[model samples]
Target: MENSRFWRDPAVPFIEARDVLDGRHVCYARHSHESFSIGAIVSGHSTYLNGRARHRVGQGTVVVMNPGDVHACNPLQDQPWAYRMLYLDTPWLTELQHQMGLGAHQDLRTFATTHSDDPRLFAGLNGLYATLTNADLAPLAKHSATIEFFTLAQQCLDPLPQRAVLAHDKLGRAADFIRANCTGEVTLAEICSVAQLSPSYLIRAFKQQYGLTPHGYLTDCRIQFARAQLRRGRAIAEAALDAGFADQAHLQRVFKQHLAATPGHYRAHSSIR
Candidate 1:
């Protein structure tokens, strides 16, 4: 009991919470998770290994552990660390990605690390963790707060730049072709054929270059188009069709499942600016 300062809530279906140890015995054994971990150091200092780099944690610092990144944490000589963390599944983050209109980024492909010195975000997260641990939040409130936390985290992190087109003639041609035809239901097979590589290799190369699989990138294209159409007063039915959905229902399901809101709801609630 003395070595265990950790408290773990029942793993929420899609999220998990942990109150971690601090002080001389503070330790997180080398481990990885299938979901992203967002951690806040409440007191003392923490030294954690992430991927190939080891980082020191302090008050107000937020550490983002991407899925599958080998990480370990312990207290510095005399100082230990106490932290609260939430692990989030990829589907949840993918939904946020769609809502935020984020593009493919290498940082998103796996785990990442970021910080927030912003008083509002940092304090808000601390309060949220308290509520989560105290069982004081309703389901709806909990979901909303989680979304807010992610939005703040993304804001604090530097987004990667759009991919650069190579000067190579063939690759440039393929890239241009893909960009131009993304919304036209271009299949990965077609892209592979045009690029003169097998589908598997092409997918690898495409992801290596674009930071998303070809199909995933293409879906983003469709979602972007739908967002534009929704903003312009198009009915969900019409927007879905124009955005290449099989039907309004198809669009509605995907929109709700991936973006956490139906198209109509998103349009009504989101800022047009």
Candidate 2:
């Protein structure tokens, strides 16, 4: 279909992914899968039903389905929506759980959470999707990222009986991390690791302390970087790429959102003597 895209590689056989840019017309009946499934709502809203539970999921919502869980999601009132889904082989994921020392080795680790809106978790999933689909990146990088993201998924989404206490002791360190990596690929896991904060704790407190979510702050940093470049009369597309935006249009959308002016307008005015 015109709205669908899929990414899978022979080197990474355990994972397969698909993203639907406009899924309002797409419909599905209640069904179960043999593999574990995780998905994020990229935009718009939908009604999500997993077994007896039902919830409305919007942008940034991450939904998890265990193997054989009957579930279905459809657009809310025919509204347009976009989403990304990743399915992992059950045995491979169960082995990963055992390797992570999450719990008993006998079964797939059940995620008590059917869904989450945690910004860190949401951003991590998007970042992972981007990485997994990248053609230039090495297979080893994709493999490492898959492991890192699922590990964080477990930490953020599953019920843990005895986890070590974590604190927001390094907000400055966190900001510095974002600033340093504004022009490169960065992950929520790295921010949590460098700041010594848990994923669940990092996003909310970072927003409270910095007045922006970690992803938001990163965008702001990139905007600032691009703005500085525009002041020097650099081209919009070049500035966008150097600032780590996906492309010029991405920079344009966000630049306008943050500055309330187009990049071209800003650059034209800034070049005045």
Candidate 3:
């Protein structure tokens, strides 16, 4: 039977979820997105294409795709395939890159291959999908699970660098401005003015120099501020607003993505010592 389930939360706007696809036989045409994507094969087999390369993937396989990396997947023969996937917006992926300490001047870093048979990644993704799709779970819990899952995934699947060195000074001023105004709404024009660069050039240069776009950098800073607030025993909702998040759920999502722990958990654990 062909079945699919999707989920989305306003707070975690940067992520779109296909929580499950069961017994689907639809063949997908070559396509690309402005977002990064990852899929976990739960059962059956399929042919995976990335750019000009092709490979067969089966149960326990993890597929990774970067933004605009043309790819598709279709079942071999009439075989049924079940899977779960997450589509992460570029800004979110950029924040992840920064969290992983990839540094500026690097392009999007992702898995070296289109797909991997690594059991760890499969298990980690499976767990994340389950947590994310479980309606009974609290936002904080789901956020924590998501972070933990990606942390494991990143550790197991070594990230490959995709670009050569670039100038860092170009965006230094813009980055500083964003960091300083991270807890507020910082506009693009403000950043461009500070950097003495045009919007387009600043966008490119900032991403190149910081491994994150200006908005991503701002989000990172807000997350950091939120973490400190949580550690200081601030209320979650208050921390969210104070840290420039739209709401507590947004804070939970971003915080978990970066820290692998929810604000509540972080506060609780921090208080334990």
Candidate 4:
């Protein structure tokens, strides 16, 4: 009983405490998040079916899920599967995406990945929870924990695309702009310069190609870059600059638009393992 309780709650706000479920408690109904959810399995095994494909999840393994990645979990054996997890916001992830040079897209899905040889990924989370509950740290303390967790998650992010969809011409160009200049602030005009099109023309062409205007696409790019940086151990403020946002607050505004959750929340949900 005590063991079960330990995994059930990390109790950090903006971060969903990890939960361990067994026996009849073993299934999650299909749903999506406005945030990111990172999972680490502790015991037994399970079959995670996301859409038509089924993947096995087990101990010491981590799963990175973006929002709207419809998935469900089932016990692999009568023994059942128990796990701990944190739910993060999308902008945080978007920041990571940008840092890692992954392009902007809103599709959130799940992928199985292995991150580390250290047990600290799991142990550190527990310790952070204890610290948060028992000790009084400065406001930056929670951010520090979140930063650690995201650093661990960075190792776990493997871009496993279950399916592939090619980007359109204009959208592809805008994507090029994003990757090349992710370290500095960018605007629609900058992207238009690279693509050699008028602002209005670029906006329409980009929208037709990717269903997003140049500015919208750029914003998403910035957000993903921020997430990637956080995952890479960069501070949110640093992530903001590295991802080309004007500032941390600017990053937050754009992050909230796509993820509906804050960057801080996103980092908290990203566990180290």
Best candidate per lDDT, number? 2
**In candidate 3, how many Å is residue 8 off?**
0.9
Candidate 1 residue 56 Cα shift, in angstroms, is 2.2
- Candidate 2 pairs with clashing backbones: none
Every model's TM-score: 0.51, 0.58, 0.57, 0.45
Question: Which of 1 and 4 is ahead in TM-score?
Answer: 1
What lDDT tens digits, residue by residue, belong to model 1 across residues 1-273? 332222223333455455555445444444444467777777788786665567777888777766544456677877756776777777777667657877644234332334445666567677667655555556667667778877876666644443233434454455566657855678767777778877777777765554456675565556657866775668889899888888989888766543334687656633211
Candidate 2, TM-score vs. the true structure? 0.58
Shift of residue 233 alpha carbon in model 3, Å? 37
Candidate 3 C-alpha lDDT tens digits along 1-273: 225445566545566566345445345545444567888988888888886679988999999886645567777887888887787777666666678786455556756667878888888888877777666778888777766776676677677765333356557667677768989889998888887899888777766555566777777778767865775679999999999999999988777565334677656543110
Cα lDDT tens digits for candidate 2, 60-93:
9999987645577888999999998888888888
Query: Would you give me the overall lDDT of model 1?
Result: 0.62
Model 2, runs deviating above 4 Å: 159-273
1-273 per-residue lDDT for model 4 (tens digits)? 422222122334355444555623535444334467666666777777554457876776555555534456666766666776566766765665556555556443334442333465566555555444333555367657776766655554555554244355655676687657756667777787777778887777666555455565566656766866664557888888878877899888777555444677666644322
lDDT of each: 0.62, 0.79, 0.71, 0.59
Which pairs of residues clash in candidate 3, taking residues 3 or more apart in a chain or in different chains? 105-208
Top TM-score hit = 2
Instruction: Please estimate how well model 2 matches the true structure, expressed as its whole-model Cα lDDT.
Output: 0.79
Instruction: Flag regions of model 4 displaced more than 4 Å.
Output: 1-14, 21-23, 96-139, 159-273
lDDT: worst 10-residue window of model 2:
159-168
